[model samples]
Target: MLPAGLHWIERWLPGFTQRAQDLGAVLSGTATSITAFDGRLQAATHDDRHVLLMASRPFLEARIRERVTALPNVRVVRARAAGLVVREDEVRGVRHADGVVEADFVVDAMGRSSRLAEWLGDAGLEKPRLERLRNPINYATALFERPTPAADLDVAAAIAVYAQGLGATGLSVASLNAIEDDQWLVLVMGYGQERPGRTLAEFRAACSELPGVFAQAASGAPTRDIATYHQGESRRRDFTGLRHFPARLVGVGDSVASFNPAYGQGMSSAALQASCLSAYLTSGPDLSVPAEGFFDLQQVVVDAAWSVSTGGDTERLEAAAGIEPPEEVRRQRQVLRQLLEAGLVDPFVARALNDISYMLRHPAAMADPALLERAAAATSATPH
Candidate 1:
């Protein structure tokens, strides 16, 4: 989780972060920095004040289940939701194999394969507009026992990105995180035709070709075989713009927007959306009408993540197709490139870039005159 998401979780569920940390979750601090490489030079940044949490998906899920099931008002149910119980365009409950479970509000958390749209359509409600970006990204991840103690690792996380003229050799992106259990979770990603291999030998060879950190992490004894996944596109459903929507029903998490996982924004985005829902409910909203307020708050988080993930994918896709972007886009890319270059040697610029990359700040923060002036000066003074 990023700092923004972690903050909200701590706010709503007090002591959640501390409990996770006590149970061996790795928290970002002065000793844990995230380093980024542009196929050449590298820069590192860390947030000592607001730290992020790192843990395996299963571990996180188990922790959440433990906390939620202990709540007095909450009951854990094991059943499949076959359909929605809609009454006069408002969802009243859910239908399962056994019977129906009623609720005042229904949250669609079925992830990317959610059937909410089809259900809504069957109920004679207007479907939300779906937007998709064809990314065609493939990822392969491997687990390894850390070669050294956690304290001795150079950085907690590192990412090497493919740049146009930086001598990249078919590798799109490579990253490794020092996760819990003294394990290193390393991943390598590629575009449509440049998929990473599934064999252990192929994984090690790819790591060797990447930066030093990747090779070092791969040197450790393998704890698990390579696991692979493919994402065809990044997508979002425009729920706010829909005219005929149901009341007492809302969507969260991947049901709203699922971006490229390479950016590590999925969980954070969902957490922030939950925070938005909390805010909307606390504001005493009208339950008879649509959840426009929640959707509006959620849109801001979705847009920030979409821009960060899709912006890079679109650039790579366009470049591979031998297509040049418009003049305005070219100018914007140029400025961004300058800021990235400046980040290598300037601490302030590096932190700013890190904040933006981690979704702690919006992309518009890059346009601050102070940041632009510093980036310009740093770019001029630094040597490539």
Candidate 2:
């Protein structure tokens, strides 16, 4: 369904991706958006990351439960988190309906609906400041399967929204992913467009503009009715920036930052966050008041993901706002656009870009003097 960084899998959860129905390489494309032509340069896959065909949500949840339940030190409690139990400025533990349970530290991984802000306020502490990019995007996803393979490429797919002027045009990108069980996960994305095709007919029309394989595979059999999901501006709660934070308390996953789901970084990013925590526990000094250093390290992790996800969505964000972005944003975007165009034609550039996409390589890899020199040269020589 998606490719994951090998670092997370090998270090944290070995054989996690093995539960997938199969393993496949991801294939992607970039298009001109409006014309619906597949003539743009094809994207290259990276060897470091792996494309996994995972089971559906329910099955994946069951697998997670099974593995976690077997751990001798783990206890699975299905209780609501009433709030935090703070003794003065220190976080003692978590409070539930039954009573109080204490711990050396507590990680609030309650996801996007995390009640951390409420708990912080209740404990007489200011909540973390939130930084947001209000693109107000929406997506409609549907599952369509075929009795047989009719697609030219049976991997993953992506469409890049074209820019008509200095800023992005008010259109969006769309995609269809080849999932396990011979099914395709169809997604129709809009920047501020909000409405994606809802009914089967509408969903088909949405797919009509996507790659042909999406339509052909989707036409065969109906796995389930079309489904829809909506997400507003991507948010990063600057927990690291909070001045009134307590020790022995931290957050992970969406609690720290909720990215645009379209990027598919939610699960993997959380895993990486957990990995960071592990590193801190093993090497860092004892936890005390103002773990600002740990939060600083976490910010580094979040910054990597934010750059990739937000950078990719530049067109949509600019388009939705209908304004020219800042000078720095424009300059970086133009450079990235050049690299993208160059990647379509050059394998090396493609590899570098793909690595950047998976967050396996720092974004600075795109700025390698040699690579940029080569890409600029390649762009000039080629016809636009």
Candidate number achieving the greatest TM-score relative to the actual structure: 1
lDDT for each residue of candidate 2 in 1-384, tens digit (9 for 90 to 100): 334433564455566555443332223323211112133644443454433333455655565577778889998777898899887778888899988888788888998889898889978897888888776676777877635442345445444443432212222556655555666666666666547677788767656555566566567667887787777778888777667888888888888988887666777777777877877777765676756666777887788888888776666556556878888888888898788788777767776776666666778787798999978987887797
Candidate 1 local lDDT, 1-384, one digit each (tens): 777778777776789888887876777654555555665654554557446677788988888888888889998678988888989878899988999999899999999999889988888898888999998988899998985665566677677787643323456887777777888889988887777757888888888877778888898998888899999999999888778898999999998899998888888899889988999999999988889999999899999999888988888899988999999888888988888888888878888987887778999898899999999999888765
Can you tell me which runs of candidate 1 are displaced by over 4 Å? 44-46, 164-169
Per-candidate TM vs. native?
0.95, 0.86
Alpha carbon RMSD to native, model 1 = 1.8
> lDDT of all predictions, in order shown?
0.83, 0.67
Instruction: List all candidate RMSDs to the true structure.
Output: 1.8, 4.2
The superposed Cα distance between candidate 1 and the true structure at residue 147, in angstroms, equals 4.4
User: Candidate 1: TM-score?
Assistant: 0.95
